[model samples]
Target: MELNQIYNNAREKMKGYCKVCPFCDGKACRGEVPGMGGAGTGSAFQANIEAWQRYKLEMRTIHQVQNPSTELELFGVKLTTPIIKAPVTGSSYNMGGSLSEEEYADIVVEGSKEFGTIAMTGDGADPTMYNSGLEAIKQADGFGIAIIKPRSQKEIIKRIKEAEKVGALAVGVDIDGAGLITMALKGQPVGPKSKEEIEELVNSTDLPFILKGIMTLDEARIAAEAGVDAIVVSNHGGRVLDSTPGTADVLAEIVSEVGGRIKILVDGGIRSGVDVLKALALGANGVLVARPLIIGVFGGEKEGFKMILEKMTTELKKAMILTGCESLGAVKGNILRKLND
Candidate 1:
């Protein structure tokens, strides 16, 4: 099954929750909460796509490179490509109840493994949402990452122990979720963490601990100071806050502040390998794809997901070769042309 076929099937299956627009831009479903659109005016969501579009790639073909490597080792885990499956939850409410939480996790973990990468599973308002993801991770021999919400210290620590039991590759807290109304509505207490609170959680995990939802240089520095192994430069896909800057717009600033101090990953409007190239050039060590993968899982399950990954990897390699980047290491800021520049 092709991506288009998968998309069509997903659209039919996920009608109300997600239109599964041809572009997947925020335009079609703006301000749609408990669904696919961004929060508020959806400007934050639209910003992500627009920011990436503004950056042009500089292509150069005159180089002695027979092959280019898309391979990367993130936090000691070998990956075929730098593309990862971003954590997602709430299949019923947010994704149209087409697939159960467990079913979604299964496709994400298994498909990522097949593609030589890892999937990051998410936590949600309901406890079962997290448990199902943990089960899928265990099934995949812990070839996955579990991202917890920014719950209270006790709750977050408790979940970390669970992730440890499952032997997850890493654990993360999307602090951006602190403002999610869904969590509050469900009576699941969640909020932002203090520096001490963040340090405590990082200290509690032997596994690499990541702090997602970092959109500012200060927060990036704080995560680095808190000793997080990595930070996902994200605006919670514009779901948590309205009118926030696109992650891409602020990624370079964050990286400049804490680049080598911590590994940096990013996700937002990243729909293709070209976008992946742009992210790396802007200083991301790796990148994640959410909406497209949702389509892949819903439409084609594991094979469909695998197909999308392979296609992106191929596109990344092509971008690398044409830009004279022989390895992932060679993909640097110079390869991108800023809109202002």
Candidate 2:
């Protein structure tokens, strides 16, 4: 199926929930948190796109690099690309229930596998929300990850054990979701963890531990000291707060503090392969994609999802080759200059 057809179907399916905007920038859906828009005026969400757009790729044609490698490996899981589907849930409430939580999980997990990458499933107030992802990952031979909300430590460890039982590639908590009143309203309270509390969770799990929503150098340092395998430089897609800097703006600072000490993944406003390359240049080990991929899922299911990944991989390689990057290792901040520069 063609790309246009996929979006057309998505627009029809996600009419009330999402407009399936030509560009999934935050403008069209501002303040629509029950849906897909960012928290308040949507400035944070727009900042994500703007942050990436401000960096122009410096072209260098006089290079021997013919093909660029997009290969990424996380916790020993080899991936053909660096795009991991961001953890998203609330199919019934947040997404219009066009697809159930289980259906979405199955498609994303299988789709990620199809693209030779892995996905991260989310947790919420609803038990089934997290369980659906676990079941799908279990069906896929534990090829996906489970991201829990920042609930109590005992509860988190219990969920971690569940992830371990499924032989998951990794387990994590969306510590950014601590401020989510929605979870508390539903009787499951989530809050920020102390450094010691975080360390306990890390020590309790044998599987690779990931701490999502690290936007500061201090937290990145703490996560490193606590011994997490990876830290996602994110702001919960600007859903948890308003008027915050985009993940891209803070990623470099965080990376400078703990780049080699811990694996760094980042999300927000990552709409294309060029965005993926930009994130890597800024020091992210990988990038997480959501809004656009959600369109892919709503429109064409697995094939549509894989098609987006294919386009991103192709665009990334083309961008890398033109930028004199033969591999991900060669991508550096020097290859990018701010538009204002």
Candidate 3:
């Protein structure tokens, strides 16, 4: 199915929850948390979009770069593109029940595998969220990454064992969800982890461990020092806090501090292939796409999501060619022109 068809279908399914705006920016759904916009004020969500707008690409056609390879080997997995599906949950409340918890999990994991990449499944306030993610990963034959919530060390380690049993490619904790009162109300206490706590978790897993929700240089360094395999430079899609800077705004700073020490991934307002290119230039080993993919599935199921992935990958290839990038590695900060410039 085409993107427009998928969106048109999703727009109807997600009617009141999401407007399914032409651009999926935060302006249309301000202060929407359980329903998909930013948590409060919606500034953080809008910031992610505005930050991308601040940088313009520099066109340079006179070069020997026709087919820039977007391929990358992330944590031993050969990927056709650097795009991974972000872990998302709560279709019932957050998405107007468009898809069942199990359905959303299955589509993302299976779709990413079909597209030659991994999907990161999410843990949420709902008890079935993590379980659904694990089941989906199992069905994919260990092709996906299962992201757990920042529950107690004992709890997280227990889930880690379960993820290992399912043969998941990797595992992670969405520490960004620490502030969700929903989790606490459900009798599952989650909070910030101390460096020592983080170190303990990293040491507990042989599976490549990731710590998502890092937005600052200090936390990036801490994740590196704590021995995380990767750190997702995200503000949890602006769902956790308000007035925070966009992922694009602070990515360069964090990369400058620990660019080579750790694998850096990012997600937030990343709506197109150009945004993906900008992420690589700033120093992301890879990136994630959430809202678009969610809406894709809502609109057209498996094909809908796959179409978005293919379209963005094609766009990234075109972007690489226009900027004279011979490959993913050739994309650098120099290809981007700042608004101030």
Q: What TM-score would each prediction reach against the true structure?
A: 0.98, 0.98, 0.98
Ranking by TM-score: 1, 2, 3
lDDT score for candidate 3 against the true structure: 0.90
**TM-score, prediction 2:** 0.98
**Backbone clashes (count) for model 3:** 0
What tens digits encode model 1's per-residue C-alpha lDDT throughout 103-222?
Answer: 999989988988899999999989889999999999999999999999888888999999999999999999989898788889998888999999999999899999999998888888
Task: Show the lowest summed lDDT stretch of 10 residues, model 2.
Answer: 180-189
Candidate 2 per-residue lDDT, tens place, 247-327, comes to: 888988898999998899999999888999999999999999998888889889899988988888899999999899988
**C-alpha lDDT values of all predictions:** 0.91, 0.90, 0.90
**CA shift at 307, candidate 3, in angstroms?**
0.4
Per-residue alpha-carbon lDDT of candidate 3 for residues 1-341, written as tens digits (9 for 90 to 100): 67779889999999888989998789888887678888788898989888888888999999899878999889899999999999888888788897899998999999999999889998888767999999999999999998999999998999999999999999999898888645766677889999999999998989999999999988988999999999898888888789999999999999999998888999999999999999999989999889988888899889898998998999999999999998888889999998872
Clashing residue pairs, candidate 3? none
